[model samples]
Target: MTTPLPVFAEPWPEGVTHRYLTHVGATVDVTGGGDRTGYRCTGCIYGSSGQYWHENVAHERAQAHAEKCLALPRPTQ
Candidate 1:
């Protein structure tokens, strides 16, 4: 029999609570204030999208985008 993969656990952010996972697939949902921010791989094998299971190439791409966004100077609000 094949062994089940291990799950990834990240520290819950402050003021943010509640997490759910399922055995049918390898996705984890994190919710706060009725808003579904995004999903993370329970197994850390897939990127933000499960389409790239076992590969975090998409995650890296997302990280690059986020970095660019952060690097951009913000306008006074």
Candidate 2:
């Protein structure tokens, strides 16, 4: 499997813009290894390329994002 791309902030190309995309659990058809199959995936890519953009292009943005994410509320059991 290919490693998923990391999110970062930078000046998006001319075509890129920020927006939120909804994600929900659903069955998806996928073909792989010469076989057609379906499976479930976790999480959702809700934001558009614009939403993924970062104010700072420097790699430091990763750390900032991490901290921000950590501050978010966690689900209660």
Using TM-score, give the best candidate's number.
1
Q: Quantify all predictions' global Cα lDDT against the true fold.
A: 0.37, 0.25
Candidates' TM-scores?
0.25, 0.19
User: What digit string (tens of lDDT, one per residue) describes model 1 on residues 1-77?
Assistant: 96684355646545333343334323333333322233343334322442322224333443344332312222225
Scanning candidate 2 in windows of ten residues, the lowest lDDT window is: 25-34
* Clashes (candidate 2): 5
Tell me how candidate 1 scores on lDDT: 0.37
Candidate 2 structure quality by residue, lDDT tens digits, 1-77: 95454343544323322211112211111212112221211122211222233323312333323323322222224
Identify the runs in model 2 with alpha carbons over 4 angstroms from their true place.
1-56, 71-77
